[model samples]
Target: MQLFEHNPIKIYNSLSGKKETFTPIETGYVGMYVCGPTVYSNVHLGNVRTFMSFDMVFRYLKHLGYKVRYVRNITDAGHLENDADAGEDKITKKARLEQIEPMEVVQRYTVDFHNILNTFNFLPPSIEPTATGHIIEQIELISTIIENGFGYEVNGSVYFDVHKFNETHEYGKLSKRKLEDLIHNTRELDGQSDKRNPQDFALWKRAEPQHIMRWPSPWSDGFPGWHLECTAMSTKYLGEQFDIHGGGMDLKFPHHECEIAQNEAAKGKSPVNYWMHANMLELNGQRMSKSTGNTVNPDELLSGNNDFFSKAYAPSVIRFFIAQSSYRSVLDLTNDGLLASEKGFYRLMDAVNLLEKLEVSKASTININAWRQSCYDAMNDDFNSPILIANLFEAAKYINQIKEGKETISAEDLATLTNTMNIFVFDVLGLENVVKNDSGTDKLTGAVNVLIKLRQEARANKDFALSDKIRDELAEAGILLKDGKDGTTYSVN
Candidate 1:
């Protein structure tokens, strides 16, 4: 485990409704399940925020030497317009509109989904299960719920008995809502002539003729419900009892709450130890949603077609922009905010490049150990990434000072600082500078060399004013330079 000196990581557990110290179920193994995207369309920025937060957690746990089996499921089927019970699956709807096979929709967007996540530098999960791959497991789970008297089948459709589950198992415990509120707030469920209560959600839905994504099951030619996919796939991969379950806060009620009842009904025990929810991403103080027409698709942003962005942003900058804020808070997207984040990101990258090149002193002037501790402290406290970033920025400033001959570092301290920055920023946070595929050209190399030489001559002549002006001007042209004790090195921004 390469954890820092002060790695007492605390995280806000939605299960306990408070921040608690994180300890995996097993001594050195962690089982984490995160709800993944429903492959109906392109994933928006709001959806990516949740994954980014979990990436931080997953990376940190791995960095701490925990053998973590991270599972994030893809909903290839069963997610519907009005929850799982109301009617048509979302993917099916898209297929109908596009006049394509349902699997075509699944394959296209699933590929697109992976591309976007990779662009943002998200590590692929240990197990990326699709709902369509585990139909038998979902059927077995529905059967168990029925045998345990918490689910009922009518007209070949199975619905969980939420009201009855509430009587014995506290159905609303996860969401902190009274059963009465749910009943009142829930409008009369559609296609619910078979359900015993309005709050009872489907565990298995009997597919109609137009529904093309169903599997043949004991119940009928049907598909698993939206919540059933997560419950079945996670338990099958991670186990009936696991450490953590995470998703967007919008899934708190009905989605996650129903999942709890389904798992308890089948397993006769709580499925997860900790519940974590990342808040939604907001746009102009309003939620960015598909229906609201304010969603920013990653592909659109990458192509510079998003109305909110005037120019295309590199993937690393977009990743950092989301990570700069705490996961639990809503990150409101603004052009000014993103521009500021771009500058900070480049500054951080510049310092990172300068760290190893720094000259070592006999004794330390800046406290690298304290800075390292602060980085761990921020992460340990519920994976507070913004604070971790702030600490990294402080470390970056010191690195810049040492590069500029303003501070000094011991040889031992230099190694520690390098290791700390690499672990926290690159491995744990999963941020990186873009690596462009450029064939080395004589013209390009000559131009860059000429600029560096000119800067060198300016510095040798005690022309501090000229040196700063050249640096600033070249920076605006997307060339960043670091003036080291020995010489200056540069990288294209």
Candidate 2:
């Protein structure tokens, strides 16, 4: 909760197109609404990466002692099948293939999404409002947009008047796209039977004869449009205006841009103070998306069973990997990167363990202030997590050296180290010792293996005394050992 002297806490605001100091709307409180997954299929690694990034922001705000009302919506309905309004509902398509009801598909994937996020140790949002849960609210929002003359109802379908919204407010403000460019590249579809412009999107889509999800609204029996849900849900939960609105960078173009227009049309003001976007996760330098045929499921990442991964990676390792990069930058996934991150991740957790066991000295030899300052300085610069992590690794190296009697720390500095790490690493960044279930047994096994390797290296280097000493030290650590044909075998006694 302590804001350090070096703390700046700058955030990249998409609205302003600049990194700005993150001051909350309400004093000491943050109202954040992030667009959740559509839940029409298992969440891809790309989606997981975005959520993890937001989790860091959410966790960090809470760590700052800010009262955060984080609202993430489950798009059980309202989201379109594609960016265009022409495609079928993704959930309905999934239901057809799975031979189940659309709601059944929603429930299954929604549960799956939660399971994967929980495995990653992400805290649940303050409120998770489903679009299906707020049909009336969405209907009311569409009505307001229509009443404001920014939308029109055609037959049973209601579409937002984008050409009209652009007259008063910059429609492409969020995406930095020009209206003329959109009109030029825009593919004219058949759905615009009554739309005022080709660039306009739906607020409510009239249900087709075979449509699975439908609700009776003032306009007609239909479902809400994809962007309408967020506009409705955020206003309903976080009020008409909120602190931050975030989602994947891909959503910035049409989805978020449309949401901005819808909110402004209904409320006469922008819904969010700041627009935050986390970049996509790429595989082999290509975006990992369903359309790209390179999507990696969270289950694959957790089990490490995907063709892209050699071994299973823990959820914390995944979180750390994403956090090591700026939220606004695309994160490339590589086998070597994960391997390097695995080592870095364990090294970090190892430092946390060392801090808990360190015996504080009366006087310090290490400069703890410099380390603390560097951490704050990095985090303050637009949540530069990679720099913060590098600083943390430096502290870890110092902690390890101190543990080995090669360095020293004062009692006060030791307490600072403990608290600093607990705040930034665990609380703010939201990394957990996910290996705790196997930590006790795993630690002993790992130590024994390391000692055996060291002893073999010593023997190879013709250091008999060092090899003997290594074996003796491990024995004291409750690991009895026997010389083996292969090398040495160890067992905990």
Candidate 3:
């Protein structure tokens, strides 16, 4: 039986504004599309949260035996400053400032984005299509919209007629805004804009003579609009309608709303089955914004080089911190929260390691089947990772009891426990054993051992200050030294 049939999965659908049961277009298969980074600058922590949430969703779907074709597009072109479809393209602006070609900026930041996501252990999407690569597809989509009478060409640029489309279909169903409200609330662009209505977004922008990124379109020598690439790329990879379309909650208004209008205008039906949105992440109770200097980069957090964190944190700790909360809720990044999660993560992993050393008895004390089912129950209820983690902690308590001989488990129950923990912790959660066994770890161990010997000699020689100095310095560097009956053992905290 398919996993969802046995253990049904529910997802919070932003389109419907409810938690709906996930039913794929085809049985036993899923096609998911998520918006990727624009590759103009370093990705912030908020972007990481959105991507990680989808990564968990992707991993869980695969774990449930679904064949998932996940497509996340790279916005290397057509993404503009302010997302207003008026300013210069982000990649082009960055290139002008750096005195290099636009492709260089895209290449540099795209590599950085991949490296950061790799550090967080994110599973790469199945198809990573780029906006620049699908220009022909975008042009075709624009042409179809025009031929369908929902788009118009003014001068050299093309704009989607939001007023015209809304006459037949609801334009703001996904965002839950009426056309009247949108028209009143829409901000007027400065100077003479080509759009008939401020709410009508660009389908194909006419490139200025000095614009660096320009292509040959039927309307003009121009580039695709900010919102056109996703519709084209998603329809190209997945069909006109797919299982899931996801992005950060901030994209819900103009970007995703425009996408819906474009697709519905060209095609007769809505393009996505379920619209999933990951909530924003905040820093110290305020929204993260780079302009206000209230943002933290992934590299800074991992390297502990920023003023926000007390010490360096492993990438796994950050990932575990994110998993502690639901993706639909706003997560505040605080030092205390991260430190607490760090302790919890280590405790969980320590129990998993101890499971192998646990001794089995003749009879089991706990119902292994019930505990296993609860894990699935938590995941099935809209991917409630926080609840799943609570269940994992309960399993950890049981593991500890088994280790202490306070509880007993039969061989079969023990095997189930082992598999359950492995699947949930490693495969589904995407967490790693951050403890390294490579040569660098060995080298560090050797150096620390030399220091331990020096400290021992200092103590023997009654050099109290030297021994205390070594201990205090190591502690400050996030290395905990445990002085046991068998000498000293050090661990990175």
Candidate 4:
């Protein structure tokens, strides 16, 4: 039997706003599409967080024995500077400024995107289709929408008739905003614009005389609109209706909403059974903004060359930090958080390294099966990684106790525990083991011993201020110190 049959998964549906038991369209198979980046610049850290969240989901589903075809598309063309269908194509604008071809810019940043993802140990999607490669499919999709009377042509450009579609169908259901509200909020369009309504979005835009990218279509020698490529490519690869559609939470309003409308406009049905959106990432405590200097790119974060972090962090530490929170919650990237995660990651790996050396006893003191089930239960509840991490720490504690000779485990239970930990840590969570000559505990003990000595000297000199500072700072870094009859000791959190 498939592993999914043994441990069912419940995914939080962005469309439904509730956790629903995940049922794939076909048995033992899942089709998932995530809206990928527009390759105009280096990939942002927020983008990395979003994709990393889904990477965990993809890894877990495969571990559950589901044959998953994951499609994440690249927007090499048609994404405009302003997402509302006005302004120059972002890639084209970048090419113009850099004095190069648009495809050159796409090539440069696409490789950068891939490199960063590789650094973070992300699994490449099953199909990484590009917008420029799917122009014909987009044209055909637009033709179908036009034939179905939901699209209109003006001059050489085409726009989806949102008012007409909303008459028979709910236009804002996915985003939960009423059509009337959008109409009220939108500014009045001048006579210069072609759209019949302000809420209408472009399906294709006519190429200007100096436009860098253009494709021949029934409407015009132009590029497809930003929203059309996803509809064309996702349906082409996954089908009219697939298992899941995912992206960052920011895409909910017009990007994903437009995809929904375009799919229903062409195929007369919702394109996905489950919709998932990973929450945004913040730097420090505030929202990451480039203008405000609160932003850090993936390269700067890993290299520690930016103003944010004190030292460079390994990819696995960052991955572990991201996994410590639910994908649905906003993740804050702070230096303290990363340091704590680095400690926790190494501690977990230290326990894993000790598993083989652990001596088996006559009886298992811990209930191995129950602990295993709790790990599965956390992941089953909407891919709750934080709870799963907590459970993994519990297992790590058990391993430490066994090493201290305070606990016992049978040979069978030891094997089971090792297999489960390996599968969840390396396979499912996509974390790489950081092999050290000396384990994390050994290093932490050395450092804490030095600090404990300094603190003892400070207390003996009646300098309580310095002693408290050392102790409190360690606590902030997720370490605890204790003084007992046997002098002082410390624990790595």
Candidate 5:
């Protein structure tokens, strides 16, 4: 049976702006598409937060026994500066500044993005399509839109006729903006634009003479628009109507709205069944932006080189911090918050370790089944990770109570508790133990044993200073030594 059979999952659909029960298009499978990063620069922490949110979603769906085909596209081309569908292509601009090929810029940052996400232990997507690779599909889509009378070409550029599309279908339905309001709020470009209306975004932009990312198209030697890539790649991989489409909340207005218009105008159907948008991440109380000197990258946070963090934090701790809040809530990255999450992470993992050493009793004081159900209930309600974490901490407290003989569990209940923790913490939450294992090799084990013996001798001889030095120094080197009733043991932290 499916894990979600008894506990139905509910998700907040951004399209409807309400929580709805999740039902996949297929019974035993799911298709999810999320917008990947535009590889113009190193990904910021806000981008990481958005990807991490979807990573959690992907993990939980697989844990529920669903075969999920996840597609996250790489924007190697088509994305523009300031997302205005104007200005230079971001990759082309970066290539010009660096005096390198546009592909070089894409390759460098794509590798960096993969490495950083790998360090954070994110699962690889099933299909990672690139925008450049799907230019033909995008061109075909634009031709269909033009044939349908919703697109027009002017001066070698193709623009989606937002006004015409709105007459047939709602153009801003995803963003809940009226067409009149959008026209009123649209800002005029400085130079003369070929677009009929300020809201009519580009389907294909005519490449400027200096633009390095040009490709041959029906209109001109140009590139696809920023909004066209997701629509093209997603439909190719996940089909016409998929289960979910997701991106950051900032993309809702014109980017996603244009995508909706393009897809409907071309295919006469909505492309996605559910729309999910992750909320923004802030630094201290302000939005993270490089221009304002308020942004911190993942490398800076992990290395503790940025002014925002007090000390270096492990990747697992960072993942745990993100998991402590609901994906829909605005998360503030602060030193104090990270420190607290660090403490909580260790506490939960320590209890998990202690579970193995716990002795089974004749009767159980706490109902493990009830507690397990509560954990599932929390996750079922829109992936409410904060509440799930609260339940996990409660289980941790119970583990401690059992260790202290204040509570007891049967052999069956003990097994259930152990398995539940392992599944939720490691599998569903995508969190690994921050501490490393030092017991794989006899040589390392012997070295640790020698240090433990030397420390024991120092304590026995009343050499308190030497003993303190040995323990503190080892702790600095990621080896934590714990003194217990039996003897001294150590773990790599």
Candidate 6:
């Protein structure tokens, strides 16, 4: 039987404002969509926490034996700097400042995003779609909305008719906002602007002459709105109605709100079964703002190169730190919090490593079945990772008790405990065992040695071009390679 048969997971639906028993539209399959990053700059730690939350959700769902089609869309275009209808495209803005092509900026940061995710042991989504790649779909969606009378064209741009849509549909149901309240709060639109109301968002933006990321459309040569890409890509991949749609809590209004409007206008039905929002992340009790100089990027934290953290933390330690909090609660990350998580993370790993050395007794003293079920029960309750982690520590305590001869497990129960612990700790939690010798620098050393050996082989084969390229790349990463007559050795600065 599939593990999901007994799991019966519950998800807190942001749309419904309560936890609901999760029932996939398909019998044993799930369709999930998450809004990915706007790759204009290096991804911050907040983005990491949001993605990591969904990563844990994805991991747990798969562990329950459901075939999941997870689709996360990359906002390569159409993401304005202010996250609204009218501002410079973030990628385009970065390109102009750096004097490079917009796609160059996208490609560079997308690679960086992937590298960071890989370092933190994140599972790649089943289908990763890009916004720029789905422009045709977005254009078609806008045409459908316009034909359905929820959209109007002014000048060269198309905007969603919020008042018209509200007459027939609830404009802000997901955000739990009323159209009147939104209108009352919003300032009146000036006659000089193209929008009919301040609440009406852009469907297609009219590109200025200086805008380099424009695409040809029926209305004009322009780009899609920031919110339109998620609707287009999510609908195209996950269908008109899917299982779950997730993003940061900050995107609940306007970004996700506009997505609901777009999909409802075009598809004529609600687009998602469960709407999930991961809460915000703060650094040292304050909002992580770039202007205040109180932000810590993933690279900085991992390398101990920033002023925020006391020492270098491994990727798994950071991942563990994030998983300790509920996704719906704002997580305040401090040096002390990370330090506590570091100790806890190693304790869990250390217990797992000692499983093989544990001796089995004739009869079990503890209820292994109950302990295993407790872990499952914790996850089944809205993917409550903090509770699940607490259960993990319970088992760790049992392991230590068994090691000290204060507790005993039967051979059958020991096997069950070992398998269950492995699944939850390594597979479901998505944490890797740390190297005790170097506090996790051994992996980097092993990787660098692989490259050094490849460069040596290239030199032996008289491929100086390949050899020189390897040397130059390692030099850029602060890994100095000294190739003596004996062999090549490396040192990190």
Query: lDDT per residue, candidate 1, 275-298, as tens digits?
Result: 999998887678877797877788
lDDT tens readout by residue for model 2, 366-466: 78888887887887787788998989899899898887777888889999998899888888788886432213356666766787788899999999999
Structure candidate 6, residue pairs in collision: none
Residue 161, model 4, lDDT: 96
In candidate 1, position 29 carries an lDDT of 84
The lDDT values for all models are 0.84, 0.83, 0.89, 0.90, 0.89, 0.88
Clashing pairs in 5: none
**Model 3 lDDT tens row, 1-493:** 7677798788899988998988899999999999999999898789999999999999999999999999999999947664344548878888999999999999999999999999999999999999999999999999999999999998788989999999999988988999999878877767336778887878888888889899999989989888999999999999999999999999998889998899999898799999999999999999988799998899999999998999999999999999999999999999999999999999898777767767889999999999999999999998899999999999999998887678899999999999999999888889997642213357778888888889999999999899999999999987767674447767676
Model 4 bad stretches (over 4 Å): 83-87, 189-192, 438-493
Please identify model 1 stretches exceeding 4 Å from their true place: 1-6, 83-86, 435-447, 454-491
Output the lDDT of residue 144, model 3. Answer: 95
What's the TM-score of each model vs. the native?
0.91, 0.88, 0.91, 0.88, 0.94, 0.87
Question: Candidate 6, after superposition: displacement of residue 376 in Å?
Answer: 0.3
**Model 6 Cα shift for residue 41 (angstroms):** 0.5
- Relative to the unseen true structure, what is the C-alpha lDDT of residue 46 in candidate 4, on a scale of 0 to 100? 90
> Cα-based RMSD of the predictions, in order?
3.4, 5.2, 3.9, 6.0, 2.2, 10.5
Which 10-residue window in model 4 sums to the lowest lDDT? 435-444
- Model 2 residue 231 CA deviation (Å) reads 0.8
Best by TM-score: 5
Predicted candidate 4 versus true structure: per-residue lDDT over 1-493, tens digit per residue: 8889978888889898888999999999999999999999999899998999889899999989999999999999947665344447888889999999999999999999999999999999999999999999999999999999999999898989999999998998988999999988987655437878888888888887778898999988999998988999999999999998999999998999999999999999999999999998988889999899999889888898999899999999999999999999998899999999998998898788779878899899999999999988999999999999999999999998998788999999999999999999999899998654223367666777789899999999999999999999999997778674447756554
State residue 325's C-alpha deviation in candidate 3, in Å.
0.4
lDDT of 1: 0.84
